[model samples]
Structures are given as C-alpha cells and as structure tokens.
Target: RKQRKEAPDDARIRRFEDRISEGKFYLSLSSTKNDPRLMQALRGRLNESAEALGKNVAKDSELRRDVYEKMKALERSLAKAKRMQQEEECFSSKKLHASIVSTESQLRSTRKQASYLTQLAAKTIPRGLHCLALRLSTEYFALNSSRRNIRNEPPKVDDDDDRLLFHYALFSDNVLAAAVVVNSTVTHAKDPWKHVFHVVTDGLNYGSMKMWFLSNPPGRARIDVANVEDLAWLNASYSPVLRQLTSRKTIDYYYYGTHDRGARADPNAKYRNPKYLSIMNHLRFYLPEIFPELDKILFLDDDVVVQKDLTPLWSVDLNGKVVGAVETCGEKFHRFDHYLNFSNPLIAKSFDPRACGWAFGMNVFDLREWRRQNITRIYHRWQELNEERLLWKLGTLPPGLLTFWNRSFALEKSWHVLGLGYDAKTSTRDIERAAVIHYNGNAKPWLEIGIAKFRSYWTKYVDYDQRYLRDCNVT
Candidate 1:
C-alpha cells in the first residue's frame, strides 16, 4: 500500500492512539495526577503537537495556544469550586449566630415579664386586711403609751413601745384608706419600678396626691399625711396640722399642729404656722428627732402637680447627698440688709449663701443625718437674736441650706420642680423636665389660672364645699 505523504499531525495522532493502548495515558496519571485530568490530557496532546512541528511548525504553534487556553479554563473551574465551598461554610456560621441572638432576646423578655408579675402580686393585698392591721396596731400603741405613762416615764431608745406608738398614730384609718387605694394601683401604665412609688402630700387638695396615686400608683405601698383637728384648730396649730399633713398616707406621713407646739430646744421664732411659712420659724427642726433612720424624704409644698412617672427621681442614689433649694435670685444673702451682722460664724458661714436652689419644695431629704446633726439648735440660735439675720434665722433657711453644706453631700437638681408662680402667658412646656410641679408664688393655679397646664390635678380632688383654700375665686 502506497502510504501517501500524509500530514505529520495525522501520523502523530495515530502513534498517540497506539501509545495509549500501551498505557501512556497511565503514565500521565502518575506524573500529573495532581493536575486535573483535563490538564493531563491537554499536556499529552501538546507533546504530540510538538513532535508534529518537526514536520509542520505552523500546526505546533496553533496547538500550543489552544493548550494554554484549555489550562486557564481548567484553573478557573477549580477556583470556582473552592469559592463555593467557602461561601457555604460562612452561611452556616451566620445562621447559627442569628439563632443564638434570638434565644438571648427571648430570655431577657421573659425575665422582665416575671419581675412585673412578682411586683404585681406584692401589691394585691386586700384593703380589709390593711384596716385590720392598723386597728390592731392602734390598740397596741395605746397600750404601750398607757404603760409608759403608768411607769411615770416616756418610752426610751430600744423600746418598741415608742416606735410602735408613732407608727400606730401615723397609720390611722384615714391614712390606711388612702394608702390602700394608692398601693392597689401597681402598674405604671407606661413604665415599671424596682421598688414601689412613695408619695407625700399635705392633703391640701386630694387633687394633687389623689391624682398622683391614680396616675402612678405604688408598686408597693402609699403613705399620706392628713390633718384631723378642728378646721379652726388645724388652721391655728403648727405641729398638729403638720402631723396631720404627714399622716395622710400609711407609708410615711408627717403632720405638725398648725398653731400647736413641738419639742422646743430654744424658742427663737415666736410664730410657726403651717399655712404661713413666715409663722413657722424652724418647724422642720423636729423632722429628724421624729424619724431618725430615714436617709431621705421628699418635702413638697401643697400646690403642685405630678405629670409624668416619678420613678426615675425616686431611683436616683443622691450619692449620699442633699439636694438644696433653688437660688431664685442670684443674691449671696437671703436679704441684702441681712449681711450687716455677718459676724456670727453661722452668719459669716452662711453670708456666702450657697445659692442652693429652692428646697426640693417638693424635695428629697437625708433625714437620719439631718436629725443626727441636731438641726433644731442650728435653726433656733439664728432665731433668738432680734438683729439676727431674719432670713438666716428662718426654719427653711437653716435646715435647707446650712445642713446641706455641713454634711458635705453634693447637690443635685431634683425632678421635684417648682412652678415660678402664675403669669398670663406662662408656658408649662418650659418646666416639662420637672418631676414635681410646685404652684408656688402668688399666681395660684386653682384661684386665678383655673386651667393652667396642670389644673386637672387640683380640680379632681378639691371638694369646693369642704375645702376652703385661699384664692378659690382667682381662677
């Protein structure tokens, strides 16, 4: 057979087929196994083409370029496989992380729900139970007081007799009724409390206190102080009225006689009336002696309103400090002329008045420390001398400013805020940040500005017939 001068490529391919039959492909598997099988096949084809170049170099060049392109395509396929595997691993990890976060959120929500329920259960005690408890307590206090009387001595320290005696009187039927109603409303309608809300009002208008209890009832208990003396006597006595005022709620209340007397270490200021602060020289003097263990207590003037939740203020630590009253005018002296006798150290020391802002007119107090330091003498001495700075001698001045400085406790602005009296165009939005709104100054809310920003507070509780507040006609 005349083997025509066939192309060299045809001859090389025929040889390759013969070599594969003799296992040359198996040799590729051993030498280039790590490379893809496709790469091995291309390399074998290139070797065939190179041999063919001996016969035709043009064909060898074309085959080499084709082999390079095929190798690049195979490398791309391997890279894609690696990227797909990596993406799958990343996707699995993210899904696991999301599941963990969801579980944590659920746990947190469950804990808060449990806490709310626990607080709710605590305040669910019946009203009848509280009345019974108070009745029993009253009998106990009367017995103890009688026993002390029979012994020809007053109850002393470490004696439950005196302690229970005070509590029993303070937690009377009227106080309990108010306290019970207040404690019954537990949820904050909007927020929650770690501890119960405690409110103190002069029972001036059940409106302010009542609205507070209604709007923000205690998660735990309520304490009120209401005066019980004859209207005429109440208006006249200082200690009794104060005692009544403090005793309106069972939690903690204090009422002093409007015209009566309290323990007088030194009588400097003659007139001390609850209605007229000018009449009361240093009545807050008795606060510590009466309740010595309290770290702080809020003092509020009657005409105020509580608009939002007060829990934030109650929760503050006060950092073992006293919050001073407001410095309405930037005067160093309460009165300019009062600076003449700045010789008394008390006067000298206080002449540079700390400009403590208005007492938590609605304020928080550090009562235990206040009583420990014996503020009564601090206040009374100021009152004794005729030329004594009358402004310095006043009850509110000494305890409100002097004690705060001596204790070295820092001052914090209270949410317990005072309203800057009335005006024809006063904007309550200005004082919205205030916790307790005091309707201070002569521009009375109930009398003149009947529909002030917080008027609903007063109108809700004032029984026009029974309540005789001054300036009822002003509004």
Candidate 2:
C-alpha cells in the first residue's frame, strides 16, 4: 500500500516541473526580443535551437546583425556625452578669465583717480590757506600803518612845463608792484627827473606807501603819495555811486555771495579775490577830479612792470579823445560781451555787443578832455543803472567800457601787453617785447598762483634782501 502512494506522488511532481520550465522558456523568448544584451545571447541560443529544430540559418544571421548595430550605437552615445562635458568646461574657464581681466582694469583706473585727487589736494590746500593767512596779516599791517604819521616830500620839478607825468592809484596790497613800476620807469626813462609819479592810495595804505617811497625813492623823480580820503574833491557823501559801493548788498555781491552761481556755471572760475571790488580799484575813474592841475596823465596800473620807456606814451596825441588805450579787439577774451551783461535790454540797446574793448592798465588820459566830455558823470550813471538792475557782473571794466566807448583813441598795441598772470600760453617772445607787462588777472606776480617762469620778470625788481619783505616771506 505505501509503494503505490509514493509512485503516484513522484509522477505528479515530475509533471508539474516540466510545465513550469515550458512557461519560463516562452516568457524569456517574448520579453527579451528588444534587449541588446539579451538579443546577443539569444543569437547563440537561436543558432543552436535552429540546428536542433532543422530551421533556416538566414533568420539567425539577421538577428545577430541587428544585435551588432545596437551595440555600436550605444558605444557612440557614450563617446558624445564625454565630448559635450569637455566643451562645457572649456567655455566656463574662458568666461572666468575675461571677468578677472575686466576687474583688474577697473581696479587700476580707480587707483589712478585716487592718486590724482591726492596730488591735487596737496598742491592747492596749503597754498590757499597760506594766502588766506597772508591776506589777514596784510590787513592788520595796513591798519597799523594808517595810524602812523608819515610824510614824504615830493621831488622838486624843473622849470619845464611839458614833463612826462605818470599817475597811479596805488594800494597797500600792491606796494611792491608800485615800487617796481616806479623803479622800472625811472630806470628806462630818457630823462628820469622829467618823469613825475602821482601815487594816490587809500587811508589804510597812505603811511606805508609814503614810507616805501621815502625810504626807496626813485632817483630824481617827483613822487607824490597822497591818501584818497585827503582828496578834497572826492566827497563820498556827495557821490551816490560811492555810497552804494560800500553798501552790504554790493559787498556781498562782489565777495562770496555769487559763489553758488559760479560753482554751478564754471567750476574753474578765477574770480576768487574780493580785492577786485576794493575802493583803490575804483579810484582810477576819478583821475580827472583827483589831478585838477594836470592837462594829461599816463595812468599805470600797479600790476605792470615797465620794460620800455613810457615817455613815448606822452607824445601820442589823444586827438581830443579823453583816453588813449590799446584797443584789445584782437585778443582772445577782450570782447564787449565778456564784460557787459547784454541780457538786460538796456545794456543791449545802449552799446554794441560786438564793439571792441580796451584795456585800462596803461591808459593815457586827457584829463582836460575827460572833464569837458563829462566822462565821470557817464561813469556814475552806469553804476547807478547797475545797482538798480544787475547790468554787469565784473568790477569797473564794464562801466569803463561804456564811459569811454567812442571817445577813446586806439593806441599802439605794443604799449600794453596783458594776460601774463592768467595765461600760461602767453608767448615768451611777446612778454619780452611788451613795453609794459600787465599781470591783469587773479594770479598776480606777488601771489603764489603766479606763473613761475613769468614771476622772474616781476621778482627781478623786488629787493628780497629788504627786512620787511624778508620778514613777510615775500620770496
């Protein structure tokens, strides 16, 4: 009975095992048809199966060829992936290198700018501060000089009535300049004694100016130093123009009040000095009234250094005109519009904008003719107009141009050569040939801003060994 049960169980187990094997073979054949690795393996198994089954060899060859193509495609794809990765790395490296170069260039530019700013500050700040301190000291010195009673007797004039008379309204700030002018004039004059110098200074500078002339008198020259306040004719109370000049509004307008407009309009403007509007500067306009005894006067600005004999100036007839000055028509910045505010219709209508302008540094004024034409009244009228409306911004020259417009006789340009102080481009030949070299701008020869090359011309006359100059560090 046991043998019979065991034999039946073993037969059933064998039958189940054969059915499972058949199912696995069909599943593998259907599922692995498209797989490259399995396709390659199946090719070998197919070849053996075909031989066992007695099937066609052509079908086996086709399956093996398809498997070979699939393997080749997979190899090509792997190579392309590697090449793409290398290109990306190369592009990234080049981009990073360009960025570094740009950053370095910017850094170098920043450093250069910083260095330039530092150098600019170093050059300007200390010099500007020194100038400020010097100005304050000068004011105090002038005040002290005014308190002292100093008198300088005028040199005796010979019997000749036709002697050359030179008049200058000098100031304390330009005492050295005045000295140089007188010295140079005397040194170059045909007859030194024939030349007369009438130097009128303000009250503050009267004593010092007189002392300077007395101590260092130009040989045999008639030098008269008088205070502006001492002049009996020039009563400030009588003149509305003079009163307005001392007013707070005019003071502010000239000094630092217009700095905002200047800064916005021109960053490099040279209009920094308040001395342009000083009382001494305006005194020249009162030449006819100042010297009632004189028929003609050769007015010289203190800023000038006489390079040639000024006696020749007296011989040039004014042809009945009040003024004989070098017509600066051909100069770079000597146009009428430069000095006059043509924006006001009154100014625009009153004068020609394109009219030629003349310089005042070396003017030969016919006082007789000036008084006859009433030029002083004309000057006063314009000053009144300016006060009422902002007619012009610059000091004195605008009113002068208007007063002596058609009445001036054009003198030879060689008599006065301007722009030695302001223009660095002024030729050395021009400076040498000039009869009178006028440092007409802000960079006066006495100031540190003056050109070093041109300074020697003015400094040549300065006696640096003098105690006062040495103490003041004028060198």
Candidate 3:
C-alpha cells in the first residue's frame, strides 16, 4: 500500500516540477516585466510541488532533501511576484479612493448652493406676488362706480329692544374679509333679519366697507359700519391706555424691543405688525363703554367665520361672570407663557403659567356685570404696568386674560376653534364641527399665506361674481 501511494506521489511531483520549469522559462523571457497570468501559473505549480514532496519524499530521506530545496526556490519566486502585484493594486486603490472623495465634496457643495437659491426664491417670490395683489386691489377700490343696492336702507331696530346682536369690531385693510364675516354670519343664522351686526373699521376702509355692505347686504341683517376715528368718546387723549397702545415706544416694545438685546439679539425673533397691536384690537376691552345700552353681546373677531347660530351663546349663563369665553388650557401652545412674559416677577407671581387660558375671538361679554365689577380699570392698570415695565410682550388678550382671570367663565372649546391660521396640524374634523373658526394669526384667510384648506371655509361666503372682487382678482 505504501509503494502504491508513493508511486502516485512521485508522478505528481515530476509533473509539477516540469510545469515549474516551464513557468521559470516564461518569466525569465520577460524578467523586468510583470505578467499577471504567468505569475498565477507559477504560484499554482509551486503549491502542487510542495504537496507532492510532503507525501512521496517522506519515505526516502535523500529524495525528500532534494525536493525540499527545489520547493523552497519555487516559493521565493511566487512570493516576489505576489508582492509586486500587491504594490500595483495598492496604487490603483489609492487613486480610486481619492476620486470617490473628490466627487463627494463636489456633491455636497452643489447641494448647499441649491439649498441657498431655493430659500432666496421662496422669500422673494411670495412677497412680490403679495405686493402686486395689494397694488391691484388698491386701484380696484379707487374706482368710484355705483353698485346695485341689495338693501335700500339698514333694518331699523328699537334701541331698547332685547334682541340678539353679534357685535364685531372689524379693523382690517382687506374689506373682503369684513364682508365675508357678515355674509357667513347671516347665511348660517336661522333668523337672518333678526340678527344685527355692528361693524367698526378704520378711517381709510370706511367708504369701501360701507359701499360693499350697501350693495351686498346679508338678507336684511342690520349692518352698521362706523370708523374708529368717528367714535367721539374713543379719544386717545382721554384714555391713557389708548395713548400708550398707539405710541411708538409701545410698537417697538411689542415688535422688536421685547427680546433680551432687542431686535439685534435674535435673528429669528417674532415681531407683530404695528397694526396687530392697534386700538381696534384693544377696542373689545371697552365694550361696556361702547355699547352702554346693550346688556349682553357676542363679540366676534373679524378673522372669525360663524358657522352656527351664535344666538345660543346668549343663553349660556355666564353664572354672573363678566366674560364667557372658551378655555384654551387643553393645548400646550395656548398656555399663559405663550403670550405673557412670565420672566418678569410681577407676571410670574400674578398668574399660573399652567392655568387654562381663554379665546377672545368668540366671547359673550356681560356689559352690565363688566361695569359692576369695574373690569375696565383692572384692564387699564395692567396695560399701564405693561407700558411701564413691559409686563406682557404683544397682544390685547394678555391684559384681557389678567383682568378676567378669576372673574371670567369657561365656555366649551367647540364654541371657538382657534389656530386655523397658524397650526396646519389642527384636525379637519374639529374645524368642521366648530361653531366659530378664528384665523387669529398673521395668515388671515383673506391673505395668500392662509392655509388653502381653511380658506374655503371663509371664502365660501365671498361673492366672487361681485364687480369689486372680480376686478381685484380676489376670487
């Protein structure tokens, strides 16, 4: 058995030796040059010879020594060839890796440039479009053309009669938004003629606002339009609160100066339009003085669209509370700190930051009770404190919140659905179910920034066919 095994091993060794000799001749022919195929073949032969010698030469000491010497020589040649090939491969790999890194760097730079251009376009394009729309609307309003009267005269109402009145102090640059509020209110009301709307606006918009209502009156609903300037009792000189609100210092404080280092401190700081802090927004505080004869009234913000009859709000017993408004404690963003600067010690101690806040858009004010509790003084005191020390940063609601803190009654959240203008994540179902939808943020539904889905809720009441709306492309 040993002889038979040795015989096969000896033959294998001889074959490998012949192959190695053939490889050596080929390699020597081009000794200075490298050939991958020639090297691979020689390496294969060396491996075969080593395996054969291990099995066959073990039985013969002399043969084993001679084969081992030949095998060592073959291995040295194979190692040299492999080392040269590896060096070439290493050089090629380095070039490939460098090329990949360079390509990646170029890609990153291109992406950043693209991102910058995209941001620039986003900011400028919308602003340009807004400016153009404003110019067209201004020209449209300038045309002094007579529109067909839908109602001959305002529906007469007895001054002493105890009828439901929806009072709205609408101070807007967009007359379309004001008209839509009236249209939506009367359209959705069960008794359109019985419902009365008291609309107040600024001096500049009075002519266009009155003209629109005269032509497109909402089914005999008593619409009264008054300019804030014409209200003889609403003099700024007489009211310190009004004077402070309209002052340049107050504007700066609310808009840019509220930050730690003012406007320069934070590049992304939020600033309100001076118009948002206007006397019109603060006018709700003086509801008792404005409508002295009226006992209770539902005050609607111009940004709101009434989907359901607000007459039911009259029966919602405020339980002797002066103001009845929807509690906003359910949302984290609606918390006290969102509006009031609690960093100040007076504000920090006065109210609970976690306490439930209320909505001002749809409120039922008990004017008689309001006067009885002297709520206006409380409101004015806070306003004065805010002016003196910057108690709260921006809105009228903060002072309203402080004044009506313990005195106000909490109404149902469904009565007023806020965040339509700002929060895009608000549930569609909740918006549809709400009796009143308020676009309380900068994105009023009349503006292009308003969410497209919510705009339909406000715009459905608009008369797109009207000559004024058509001329300005308001539709």
Candidate 4:
C-alpha cells in the first residue's frame, strides 16, 4: 500500500506542477484522477491542438499585415490617379478658355471691319451720275499719260504696265475727296517721269478723261490750263486726236431726263432721284454715237490712276472676244443679287468672271456682234417698262447689265480693280501687281489726306504750279 501510494503521490505531484505551469491548478487533481493512459492521450491531443492554434495565430497576424499594406498602396494609387486626372482637366479647361478668347477676338475684329465698310458704302456712294461722271473724267486723265509718241505707234511698253499704273493711282488715295495720282515725271531736279506721284483734285481730272486723244502740255504730261472753269472743255476739245477724227466722229455730252406727270402726284416720289440712273442710261444710248464703228465701247469713271502703260492694252488683239470688266474685291456696283431681277431668256444666266465684270468701265467690245444680237434691246425694253410703271417719274436702268455679260465676256482681275467708292490702302506688293486704280468715291487725294500712296501722286500733279493746290484741301 505504501509503495503504490508513493508512486501515485509522485505522479500526482508531477501533474500538479504541470497544471501550475499551465496556470490551471484546478485541472491537476481531475487530471490525476482520470485513467493514466486516457489522461496521457488527452494531453497529447491538447498539445497537437496548441500547435495548430499557434500556427493559426501566426498566419492571422501575417494576413493582417499584408492586407494593411495592400490597402495603403491602393489608397496612394487612387490618390495619384485622381491627381493626374485633375491635372488633365485643368489643362483642358485652360485650352478651352484660350480658344474661346481667341474666337471672340476674331469675331469682334470682323464685326468692326464689316460695320465700318457698311457705313462707308451707304453714306458715300449716293452722288449718282454727276459724281459718277466726275469720277470717270478724273480717272481718264490719271490713266493716260502725255507722250511725245503718236497714238498710231505700237505700244512701247507692255499694255499691262499702263493698266497696273491705273490701278495704283486709283487705289492709293485715302478717300473720294482725296485720291492719289501715281505717275512717272522726268524733270530737271528729278526725273518726274521716272516715278513722280501726286494727288489730283477731282476738278482737274479732265486730263485723264481725254488722255485717249489729248496732247501733253509743253514739257508736261498734262494739258495747257487757262482757268479752272475751262478745264473740262479744254481737255475734251483741244485734243490732237479730235482733229484726227474730224468728219466721221464727234464727242458730246449725252443727257436724259424725265418729267413729272399728274398721274403720280406724290411730290415726295422723287426721294431717290432717278436722275443718277439717267446718266448711265444716256451713256448707254450715246455710246454708239461716240464710238460709231463699234457696237460696244468702254466707259471709264473718274478717280482711277494707271501704273502701267496703256498702249499695250489698246493694242491687245481682242479678235472677236468682248473683254468686259475686271472683278472687284470690295463693294460691287453690279453684284449677282441685283442682276437676278434683270434676268430673262436673253440675260437669265448667272455671272461668270470670264464674261461679266470683265471689261468694267474700261472695256473692249465687238460692235458688229453686239448690234447683230440686239445687245441694247434689253435696255430699250427696260426703259419702256419704266415709262409704263410711272409716267411722271424718270426711269433709269441699273448697271447690273455688266453681270449679265459675265457669261459672254472676258475679264482680267490683275489688270483692273474698282475702288468701289473709297480709297482702300494696299501694300507695295498689291501696287506692283495692280493694273488700273479706280477711285469710285468723292474724297480724292487732291482734296483730302491720309490715303496710302496718293500723296506722291498729288504732289506730282501740283509740282508744276506754285499755286497748283487751289481746288484741293491738302492736309
């Protein structure tokens, strides 16, 4: 009994010590009372369970660290992506803002330019035939130069040269009252013929108008002047060319007018005076008489200056072609829209640069063909229609007939460009290329200032006289 008990107590003591180490003293007696093999087996199982728990705890801690690190990385990546997206958005916004600003500036500039042009057109171009004729007369003098050579001579220079000079002279001026006259002046002090330029008053434009047949004044490219009043007559009458055309040809001013009838008793009906239209109409009628051998003739308005020599232009062999007019860059007196109303079986077609706006005021025509085709028939019919519409009112036709010829004519843009009633400044490049300078406005170089390239022409015209600037208001 003592021996068995001693062993049991020793085993019990060992188990107690094990329970103490495990922090569970209550489990020592219970474990010791259980079957020895069973207890031992239970202890073995508990050890295995403890090992599994330790592995599970370690794995859990490792998993937590990995998840935390992964989350932090994802957050940083998201923030970076957001920052990059914001930068792109900001850049896009800036570009859009810039584009809008640029577009607005362009639109404003365009609007301003359009407004200025519109105002000018409405206010300045209403002078009708008196102004029209004046302009034409002035341009004639400006384009044709006085030369020692005879008219029958072969054009010395390229005809285009004269044409270009005309363009430069007409375009160089700043306003209707201020038009430039570009010319070559050879003089003692300087070769005034080399590249002399000056401003010409509209009043003194008679020299250009009759240059086709006029003689130059002594030692000058102009005509002799007695007084300002006789300028127009002297230029038109005292030409060497007039002597040549003695019996067969004649030159005179064509006139047309309408009287008020009792039918349309409205006194205010004359608000838009039809007199201006009459001048063109009368011109159309008298053109045949002035240039009798031909069915068509050229009609030039004043305020044009020629840069190139015109001898070549007259020498151009037109054959059977009708070179009508040049295409204008700015405002057009006879645009397509205006021609639409005049459309008919004879003139229904749209404008063609080859045909319409080709010869312009400076024209070359096939007279025989024009008469055969009844070219003036349309004008006659229109005049009749106008008479029927208002018995008392003056009926006048529009210049839109030029557009009707667009299909049956030839035009040279490089050779001719109308000023469209104002002095439009151009660069030297433009001047070099231009053929005829047409001044379609009232403010001429001799009368006004601030026009490009016109001052030189004005000075040339006035160079001969100490008091040559009588008619013009030079600034």
lDDT of each: 0.40, 0.67, 0.70, 0.38
Best lDDT among the predictions, by candidate number: 3
What is the C-alpha lDDT profile of model 2 across 171-290, one tens digit per residue? 333467788888888888877767778887767555556666655777877787777787766656756567776776655555554534344332222332345456677877888777
Worst 10 residues of 3 by lDDT: 260-269
Candidate 1 on 170-219: residue-level lDDT in tens? Answer: 21122233342233222221333222223322323223333323333344
Q: Give the least accurate 10-residue stretch of model 4, judged by summed lDDT.
A: 249-258
Indicate which candidate wins on TM-score.
3
Error of 3 at 168 (Å): 4.8
Poorly placed runs, candidate 4 (over 4 Å): 1-114, 121-286, 289-298, 312-317, 321-359, 365-373, 380-435, 439-459, 462-472
Window of ten residues with lowest summed lDDT in model 1: 163-172
lDDT of 3 by residue, 320-383 (tens): 9999999988887778888788888998998898878888888888888999999888887787
Candidate 2, after superposition: displacement of residue 245 in Å? 1.6
Q: Once superposed on the true structure, which residue ranges of model 1 sit more than 4 Å away at CA?
A: 1-220, 224-274, 277-283, 320-350, 353-356, 385-395, 406-414, 423-427, 449-475
User: What does candidate 4's lDDT look like per residue over 1-475, in tens digits?
Assistant: 4665334324533432343234222124343224464345434444443333333343333333343343343334334444545666787799999999999999988886765454444334333323433544565545535542223333234534533221111111122222223232123213222221222223344343333123222132322111133334323233222231231211111011113332333322222232232222244333333334433333434355555554344445555554455654244444444433433433344333222232244454555555655555544454444432221133222333431343244455656655523545544466457665554443444433225555453345433321222223222
RMSD of candidate 2 to the true fold?
20.2
How accurate locally is residue 115 in candidate 2, as Cα lDDT from 0 to 100? 51
